[model samples]
Target: MSQLFSPLTLRGIQFNNRIVVSPMCQYASVDGFASDWHLVHLGSRAVGGAGLIIAEAAAISPEGRITPHDLGLWSDEHIPGLKRITNFLKANGSVPGIQLAHAGRKASHNRPWEGGKAIFPNEAEGWQTVAPSALSFAEGGPVPTALDDEGLHKIRYDFREAAERALEAGFRVVEIHAAHGYLLHQFLSPISNQRTDQYGGSFENRVRFLREIIDDVRAIWPTDFPLFVRISATDWTEGGWTPNDSVALSALLKEQGVDLIDCSSGGNVPHATIPVGPGYQVPFAEQIKREAGIPTGAVGLITSAEQAEEIIASGQADLVLLARESLRDPYFPLHAAHTLGDDRPWPVQYERAKPRG
Candidate 1:
């Protein structure tokens, strides 16, 4: 059997194939609730035969949301809608996962469709954003408040509570979104984090926040379920977070019971020159897996069955996550299986549309 279609067992959860639906934000929620849009968006990917479907980054608190419309897990009221989606995903043979996120200084921004500008806390649909350091993501943008000890402690508690809520929502995998210049990544990157405290400066100090979050989440997350950490392997700029940093961090995460690293890049620095191309981020996964001795997921510009198959076949990455391509073709996994001559079952309702054997 093709490795791309092979089963991968992480912790006690068995994935039917290596293809995962990478979390893509659809600014379609209200008050942090998962609406029917989320149900259909995630459910269709499951129906399309992905082994795993990671829901879009769900904020741990209202202030953590990237935009007002981003999904959230901070309230018990959010559970039923998520539970409904998980039920559908599991019934369709896909493991449902969620990327728990805090956007830090990037929070309180207009949605992409709405110009993507920073919104003032006093303005409509906006609130004060917080981060490791009081800095603006770009010139003339709003400056975020540097997190105090009490705020930091609250964020940690929020993560643990979010993990508990995810479990109650029946999610099988819980991925911490430490990548893409978000709250945790802010602490990790020297370019963003400028604190003199225990959570910044030296590598060990910078990684303290993420390490503590892993400890908090794992304390509540079940042992049998997998825990994934999504990280931007590089900032693509000098004096920024690098692939080496990712490898080092992955090593510590592995020791803390993190099952996999979802490797992507270039969200930390707005001006970083990333060589965007096909499978551009795959090398990060390869290096981290080889150097850190941890399983990794390769994402970014991976759009073809052949390309994805080669990645897994070459042992470059243990999993291939598709975002834009999956959006374009929700059934990409089923189509990929057929393209690679790996027989994956199509849903009974769609079997007639399946291509010739």
Candidate 2:
């Protein structure tokens, strides 16, 4: 078998292959609970042949949601549904993972297809949103209330409780979503973080929230299970968070028990012109892996088998994470095994589709 299909044992969790299902929010949850929609949405991918299947950004608290519809792991009641999905994924040979996130100023918004506007706090279902600074994503976006020391502490507790719930839900991997201009990212960027407090200003100060989260999560997270952090390597805007910042942060995360850096870019700002191209973000993963000495997952438009293989073979990244391509072809990994001429077995039920060897 090639490197991509080789067994990867990190800490104690072992992956059958390197294909990880990148977290893509379904925006389909109801009252922060995963429904039947998520079961089939995620479980089908596991059956389709991904080695690691991570659920979408699950809000740590209700107000932390990107939309009213986001899945959450905040309460004990949310565990049963998630446990069902995780059990299914594990039974099918996929390592179950969850992306823990707080959307910050991006919270209380409608879904992208539903105009994507902020829901006013005075409105029926809307409430106050919080961030490191009182900033909004755009003109129509809500002006989020800045977090006080007490509020920050509350969020930390919220995350801690959610981590406990994730453990109860049978998840093996926990990835803290600190990227995409979310609450954690809001604290990390000078463009958004206008606070004079310790949670803002210098790099160490800006990254303090994420650091505290890693500390809190590591306190509860099983050492045998892997912990990952997804970071936007650059904000793709002038004077925003840069790749150097990511390298420094990755180094700190490694010290904080983070096993991998999922390198994805260009979500802190919507206007910044990203030099978009196929596999454009792979270099970010490459840079972080080499500079920070941490295993990184490369994502963004990595659509083909050869593209994914060359990424691993040439060492651009330790793992290739696919979102859109995986959605387009859920069976890509099985087909890739055939196209790449690897002897990896297909699902027994689908053995007839296997290429003659």
Candidate 3:
């Protein structure tokens, strides 16, 4: 049997296959509410046969959003629309998950198509961003307010509350978005975080914020459900967070009850050169899993079924998460099953289109 098609259980949840839909931000919400676009965008992937479909990063608070239009779970009112999406995913046989995020200094930016530039607080649809240090992501960008003790506590509270809302909204898994130059990643990388407080200056202090957030979230996230953390295994810059740091962090996360580390790389540094290619980031997952003694999900440019199968079969990573490839072909898993000659089932409505052996 193909390892990609083999069932794996994490906590009490059993994934029918190793394929996952990596959370891709839609930037289609209004006042932090999921709209019909999200329902169809996410629901189609579930119907397309992904074992797990992680919803895009939903900001824990309005200010944490990457853009004004980014999805949010800061309020109880955001539950209804999210519940609708999770219900659809679950009913279609896919595990529904969410990524709770805080964008830090990268917040208040225009959508990608709109030039992806920072929007000043005085501008419409923009607000003051916050970070571990008073640094702007780019020159002339809005200078963020350095988060104080109260601010740090509030962020942890926000994350805990978001996980509670995710549970109430019918999500079964919650992956904290600590990667991709977001708030947590900012603190983790010394390049972005320059503070004299307990939340910065040293490796231990930098990870303190994320570690405590996990503790707070796990308080209400339930023991039976699995929790995942997405981390940038390397910042791709000298003097920035490294793979060794990721290995250490993963072990700490495992000790704190995290089930998996979704390993991706090179988004924290603004101008760091990354050797982007097929399976370029797979080594990060491989190293983390081996050194940290934790299961890992490999992501980044892994578009082919053979490559994905090899990753799992070779003991490199336990799961393969597809992002842009899933957008091109939502039914990539179904196609993969056919290519690998695995007996995975297709949705009944689409069974006629399933390839015959």
Q: Scored by CA lDDT, what does every candidate get?
A: 0.95, 0.91, 0.94
Cα-based TM-score, every candidate: 0.99, 0.98, 0.99
The regions of model 1 sitting more than 4 angstroms off are none
Please provide, for model 3 over 1-357, each residue's C-alpha lDDT reduced to its tens digit, 9 standing for 90 to 100. 899988889999999899999999999999999999999999999988999999999999999999989999999999999999999999998999999999999999999998888999999988989999999887777999999989998999999999999999999999999999999999999989999988889999999999999999988988999999999999999999999999999999999999999999877778889999999999999999999999999999999999999999999999999999999999898889889888778888888877786
lDDT of 1 by residue, 213-274 (tens): 99999999999999999999999999999999999999999999999999998788888898
Candidates sorted on lDDT, descending: 1, 3, 2
Error of 3 at 341 (Å): 0.8
> In model 1, where is the ten-residue run with the lowest total lDDT?
265-274
Mind giving the per-residue lDDT tens digits that candidate 2 earns over 1-357? 777787788999999999999999999999899999999999888988899998999999999998999999888999999999999999998999999999998899888999888898998778899988888888767788999989999999998899899999999999999899898988898999989988888998999989999999999999899999999999999999999999999999999899999999877786889999999999999999999999999999999998999999999898899999988988888888878888777779888877897
Residue 351 displacement (Å), model 3: 1.7
Please count the clashing residue pairs in each candidate, in the order shown. 0, 0, 0
What is the Cα-based lDDT of residue 137 in candidate 3?
A: 82
Best by lDDT: 1
Tell how far residue 317 is off in model 1, in angstroms. Answer: 0.4
236 Cα displacement, candidate 2 (Å): 0.9
Residue 158, candidate 3: Cα error in Å is 0.5
**How far does residue 166 in candidate 2 sit from its true spot (Å)?**
0.7
